[model samples]
Target: MEVYSEKQQIRAAIDALKSKNLTLGLVPTMGALHDGHLQLVKKALANNDKVVVSVFVNPTQFDNNEDLVKYPRTLEKDIALLKTVSRNDILVYTPTIEDIYEGNTVSENFDFDGLEFEMEGKFRHGHFDGVGTIVKRFFEIVKPHQAYFGEKDFQQLAIIKKLVEKHDIPITIVGCKIHREANGLAMSSRNTRLKPEYKKAAPFIFKTLKTAKELFGTKSANKIIEWVEKQFANHDLLELEYIIIADTETLKPVKRKSNQKSYRAFIAVYADDIRLIDNIALN
Candidate 1:
């Protein structure tokens, strides 16, 4: 496994691989390697000749300074975790903020076809712009044949696909399944900040999502939404942020379920200070 912090050297290495006709896969991540992240690496390795996993906590992506500061940065442990599943050709790029952004850390404004108008976009404000800028930068830097992203951030996955389409980037954006703990809590870097009791109650979020899925066809979207809200309202530790049943493609909230249209139940919750989000497909 080769680790690099310099962009030029990494690009040179990638050029060498390309010369040999190697198919490269990229997994862009903000480091705090859990089994969920390793799963993405494994998926990349299974499909490509070589894989590059980036471990930089992008400042542009964080809307809140406190959230950015509190975000986990376990690069040493991240590298060790990667080593467990990493092959010889796996390149871990640990670039500094200066390396990624040069002198400026500001995000580029992007039009995600109004896909950024709801949910996180409404809440965080300019959050997707930052995500778009950093992701676009990663695509330019890596120039990989395929890039992998976990579907836990369902809306963000949609935005990224749109990003590639709008730019006409010749790269496959692969969406992997949302990985979860044995207890059903969706795996997130923020999970590290979860307190002991909150962690114990966190699995309730997934349970609520499951129930909402079960109620999809029989109950109205609004009914399911109401039920999910009520479930969290009674919980002692978890506080519901937003829960919506929306079409999978357009991401518009659906009042009535259509047989022809696919839908998903998306939920955001706060286990005290830690904000976690999860979604389940409802067909």
Candidate 2:
């Protein structure tokens, strides 16, 4: 695997690949590579002729400056992890903030058709705008045939889809399944920040989602949310942010089951200061 921290060098490399008529797959990530990120890389390798994994902990995406400061950056370790996944022609684009922004940095205002008005959108103000800005820049730079993202950030996936459609970008946005630990906690870069005890209790988030899914057919959305709240009531370390049952496409809160549309349970919990998010499909 070859690593490039300069934008021009990476662009030239991608251009060389394009000359060979090779399809490029992209897995954009903020470093601190974990099993979850490896899953995306593996998928990219399986489908595309060549894969480019971009690792830049985008400062624009963080709503909290402290969260941005606290975000993990392990480029050396990340490169090592990428090497384990593929010994083939893989390019790791780790660009500097100045290289990506080029001094004319501006926040993106996206109309996600009300997709960003609740849950994560409501909680983290201008969070999706930051996400849109950075992702749009990556799309422009990488120009890959396809890009992969995990369904762990379901709403973010939806917003990216909207971004692609709105821009008429010719790239397939692939949403991979959420990769989880053996204990069922969704793997996240922020998981590294969790305290030892809070780490042990982290699986409770997924456990609650499982229970909420099981109750979907029999209980109303509000009731299921109430039940999830009560389940976490005894766990002092895991503070609930939001437990929402919403339409899979619209992301608006679902009042009842729909025969035509799918519903999903999305949850955000503050395990001490480390925020964790997870979602499960409701059948």
> What clash pairs does model 2 have?
none
lDDT per residue as tens, model 2, 1-283:
8899998999999999999999999999998999999999999989999999999988777788899899999999999998898867689999998898888665778887888887898999988988999888889999999999999999999999999998999999999999999999999999999889999999989988998888888889999988998988878789998899999989999976779999999999999899999999997
- Candidate 1, pairs of clashing residues: none
Residue 216 CA displacement from its true place in model 2, Å: 0.8
- Cα-lDDT of candidate 1: 0.92
Model 2 lowest lDDT segment of ten: 103-112
Most lDDT-accurate candidate? 1
lDDT of 1 at 262: 93
Over 4 Å off, model 1: none
